[model samples]
Target: MASIKQREDGVWRARYRDEVGKEHARHFALRRDAQRWLDEVAAAVVTGQYVDPKAGRITWDEWTREWMERQSWAMGTHEAAAVAVQSVPWREGQISSVKSSHVQAWVAGESKRGLAASTIKTRLNYIQMSFRAAVADRVIATNPALGVKAPRSRRAEAAMRILTAEEVREALDAADEFRGFVEVCVFAGLRLGEAAGLQLRDVNFLGRSITVARQVQGSTIKAARIVAPKYESERTVYVPDELMTSLAAHVTRAQVTAPDEQLFVTPLGRLWNRNNAAGEWRRVRKDARLPDEVTLHTLRHTFASNLIAQGCDVVTVQRALGHSTPSITLNVYSHLWPSAEDKTRSATASFMGEIRDSADSVRTETEKPQVRGSRYR
Candidate 1:
């Protein structure tokens, strides 16, 4: 309940207790203004929308630091999210002061600055997540980022460069000592970190399967740390005989017989990280004379392409490539799947061809009906 009265200063004062029994008051020059404020607070409380006026004064940086501390994200994920949080234009402003217009303006500015749409979208996602948490915590009345839209991603429309068998062979030959790493990526669809994190125990020779449970984090060996696979995509991936044989040969050649030893390491017996392997990757790419757009990741695309060509469904491809969802797999490789229209057209053409081929063997009922009435025809 709220009450209004004339204060000692001859001003109208409206006072009320919130749902939690916290007293609040506002003074206004006019009695109507005081009454209106009381009514608004009453309505907000009834609708379960009451927020402590002071709770939202925390700045974006302050709230984000608190929120991040509560998250159980991986080290790489935590670092990336921190970067996104730092990129917020309103990091120094109070969280409640942000409006939808401000978010839209920031997005527009990012686009004008020529940031990749994907990067902007990722950052926007992190912002939205934080804002949502704020709303749930009653630190803000609503999420300003709820309806904001990110710029369209151009990378989605770009053509993927899938390598051919001959190209794979040439790349393997050119990779020299790094052939095993490239082979795992191409055949098993492991990402760079996942491939580098492999240990002898991860391989099951009898089953010909490689278990992808963890990955090496950081860009260099000195800073590397083992972490769970991205999106918790830990599963066993079956490999072909050739890949299995290659792994065996690699193990024997490297003398890494210890089950806990890394499957792939530099010649110096240190772990292989992307930074240390980049120079050799460049040399191989050049020596193989591959397209400029073809990168180490292209081999992963090639693996998915082969699966789709072999009639693997979206779910199968998703699991094989360790994508978090089937939709993600389709988003990147939908164009590679044979369209229903193409299948229909091929079926109709094959049926027509069969009809034409058997046309001479067909006879109408009237052509053979002349002797049908005879008892012994």
Candidate 2:
């Protein structure tokens, strides 16, 4: 039974037992207001949607740290999120009090700070994921980030540059020690981490395929550790015979002592990370006469572009790039897929020619019947 009593100050105090039989009291100026609050509390308890008001008092930074600790994200993902969190003032604010407008404003601020669109998207993802965790814990009703947009400004719309075959040849020629590494990237579309983590056992020399099963990821290049391929990108990708030959020569020169040894590494066998061959990569790009903006990752986009120009299917490209979904692959490289303008003309011509042939055959049959005096007549 609910209880309503007039206090010494003449305010009405309503007392009620919640679902767990915990007593809670709230004061109101009028008896009816207290009664209304009690009724709403009863309804909420019956609906199993009741939330403790104090549960969401924790700051966003605390909750995000808790949630991040519970997640088994890769080291690179963790590092990226940490970098974004450092700049977020909302991390110190209450998680429940954050509104959609606040998130939108924050995204706009990040864009104005000259952060790239991709980096801003990563920050937004961190925010969205934290809010989603709060929702799962019943600390908040919804995720504010769901309604927010990480604006992609004009500066973020640079067109992707694909290297020509001559440029690829020149880069490989100047690559010197890193030639095999560059070849694998341009020829097989292997990500830097994936290429760095490749072991001798994962390659099938006779089959001419490299199985991507692991990758290097950590806070620092020298301190990196091996983990499973990103986004479940573990799959087999075939390389050309010439690339296979190059790989073989590189491995032989490396003097690999163990079949399980990593294929590419320093002369002393210190495992390679993205930074290990930076000097070699710079020299290769410069000697090839490529622009300063051309990074080693540029080979990945070039690989996809070349495959698409050669009429590779979307699903195949998605698999090759280890994209989580075909839509992701399409979103980045959809334009590369052949529009087949030449094929469109050929298709129309073939259909019209078939119709003409059918009409001619019918007309000849009708004319022969009348011209030769039909056998039936």
Q: Which candidate ranks first by lDDT, i.e. highest?
A: 1
RMSD of each: 5.5, 7.0
Candidate 1 similarity to native, TM-score: 0.85
lDDT of 1 by residue, 315-337 (tens): 99999999889999998999898
lDDT of 1 at 156: 45
lDDT of 2 by residue, 1-377 (tens): 57899999999999987556778889999999998998887776677556666668889888888888998887888887777766677777788788999888888898889887877988888888888878878787667889687876333125677888898999988988778789888999988888888898887889999999998875355678898988769999987898888888988987765778888875566766767666567878888899987887889889988888888899999998999899999889876765579679878999999999999999998878444666896
- RMSD versus native structure for model 2: 7.0
Collision count of model 2: 0
Off by over 4 Å in 2: 1-4, 14-16, 26-49, 84-86, 153-158, 275-283, 286-289, 340-342, 346-377
Q: After superposition, how far is residue 367 of candidate 2 from its true place, in Å?
A: 28
What would you estimate as the lDDT of candidate 2? 0.82
Which regions of candidate 1 are displaced past 4 Å?
8-10, 155-159, 219-223, 274-293, 357-377
